[model samples]
Target: MRILRTWECKIDKEIEKCKQQLNILSGVSTNRTTVLKIINDVKKHKDKALAKYSKLYDKAFLSPKDFRVKDNEIEEAYRKISLPFVKSIQRAITNIWTYQEHIRISKVSPLKTGGIVLDTLYSPLESVGVYVPGGAASYPSTVLMNAIPARAAGVNKIIMTTPPSKDGAIPPERLVAAKEAGIREIYKVGGAQAVAALAFGTETIPKVDKIVGPGNVFVTLAKKEIFGYAGIDMLAGPSEVLIIADDHANPSFVASDLLSQAEHAPGISMLVTFSELLVEQVTSELNRQITKLKRYADTKRCLKKFGVIILAKNIDECVEISNKLAPEHLQIMTQNPRALLCNIKHAGAIFLGSYTPVALGDYIAGPSHVLPTSGTARFSSGLSVNDFLKRSSVITYSRSALKTAYNDLAEISGAEGLDAHTRSVQIRLNSRSGF
Candidate 1:
């Protein structure tokens, strides 16, 4: 694997060396005030800090009556796995519930004017909590990408959790992908005291308004310190890709899409190109396909420290250093990747050609492999059904529409000091004269 100064690189020092190489994806190497004092002693001794951090980090011995996971152990984990991994988790939960059942969003106009009326309402978010990471293994594809978009946004109580090995069980293909995403509330609990028992609630879990997946970094700093007491799905980092190749791409399909996101362990796998002979034929096909990789030491330290093979002096300077390294899987492989995808602004998922890798958008290309890493796809997205719905705004007014905006609503509620919102609109226009 060659580096040769990424072929005289200098596009603002390769975008300040990919933002100082994402300071090793700033996460998971513990000690944040000793994991926030064991997640504030599992949020003030809940189930005795989840059976003493499940016997000091999954060496097992959990109790509180073995913390949920029954129903004949989800029919004995669907009769002990493999029926082609249970029909590949029933074809990836029917392609992520038919691609998040087309991210619904309705409730529109109830509009009128003089006798005013307006609208908005969509609801659906009773309970959410989904975690699914079993350390160094078992994801069951993050339980079909966070319970198939909270069961296509009609949520109503999905609850799940992981981490229980060392001998305490819980990973039979993560309860057969949470019982094929219908999620029969399984729990065992993982780090940061399973995100403080799904953000504080303990008699045996059940306090969740929102909490999706992907963890480590003490469960993403205990979901960034219990985000406003709940609701969280982003702040996730570590896991990236950039690709952008040319010179007719493939050196064994760009070394298997840079070791399939560098075995997603301390991951970040760049390869921006303008071809120094296809970066020495994709660095000798990533040293002969990384000796038939099996997470070859975490894909060789993620291709030797946040990999790179950059050359770029064309292909629009490798799409301007992949829009300043906005990679969370941005593959492109040119020669008209849909005419450079109208100058891709930033990417959380792009995968245009070379048989569209990025592992087919990480399992049968529906759209979400829970994206937006470090550069936060230059804003944020991925994980939809608009993140399990919630919207409300509707109004109605009459009395000749408050006497046609009574003095511009008392001059904008007396210019913001809000004098009881301008004497309740001048006591309903001076006791109803509608003036």
Candidate 2:
């Protein structure tokens, strides 16, 4: 990693690059043409399109009959995973469930005023589809992070979709995680086709009220296009971490955190601190520790493109820059992380102290790892039970209350040139029989 002074012109250039990475839709790979074609093909052909694309992309040949994973397959998945995996999944589920149950929205009594009743009704989505990416690796954590929250929110129907291997097999760990997370419905489909299947529904897969989870460029584009037709969680951009450390912070821990985030090909990692000595120490540690990672090439590439160390005047300057970045993950590896916690205005998730790594949050920290990426943290938040729930403002008024609101309502309706709106209220007020 290279060190750049905060006062240098190069730091401004680097910030612009970070902005570009945060904008998920602007990349060349996000071409809407291919995504639209896939969506339209699936919309028109349904199951046939799904099978065709499954063979083409995932190399898993299947028919409409084989699209949905059966009960036997999930049981088989449990057998394939290790005992330790089961224990780990159980712990993760318990933690996530406990946290979600606590934070979930609940019913509240209506606000009663003079002849008026106002209610805020919270209801879970009827159904939700979770899209888990399939590749060389299986993201069991992804399954837990997405589905557990929905389940906790009281969503009755939770289905999952993931790509299959050439052998027409989904990852056993992923399947086990899905089952554990309260998702019984698993689909053997992936990519834009899978998203389309979920959004529009098919002969096999049921249409969901909303879709939640992350994916590759294609999956992301599919979610972006399918937003209004069905609800979407968020258009998550590249994963990123901004680490603010002090001279007292452990250089090795800071470097490892940055490298772990860099494992994502398009991921970003930054170090903003006041100590030039700490910057040098971390850079040295990054060079030493990165060689040990399995995904060395990708991590190296990520660091080369999106990694930087900024020499700040103090922790306050670091916080100010961090607010502007609105990073997906903000790790404060300072001497006193909580001392500066109140000033952190942006960031999807903040990991405080030297011991709390983003990886812990990614796996078992009880918060959904499905967080808003890029600068979206400024306006949005990480996934939780709340995302799976919708609120409706319910209002009721007695005849006396209507009379009280009549003048203002009629005046506003008339000003807007909506005669029917005013008449609708007048028709009720004018009725002598009701009074």
Per-residue C-alpha lDDT of model 2 across residues 344-430, encoded as one tens digit per residue: 999999999988999999999899999988799999999999999999999999999999999999899999999999999989988
C-alpha TM-scores of all predictions: 0.34, 0.97
> Candidate 2: lDDT of 385?
97
Candidate 1 collision pairs: none
Q: State the lDDT at 84 in candidate 1.
A: 91
- In model 2, how large is the Cα lDDT of residue 110? 97
**Model number with the top lDDT:** 2
User: What CA root-mean-square deviation does each model show from the true structure?
Assistant: 19.1, 1.5
Tens-digit lDDT track for model 1 on 180-242? 778878888887788888888888897898888887777877787788888888867778888
Model 1 sits at a Cα RMSD from the real structure of: 19.1
Off by over 4 Å in 2: none
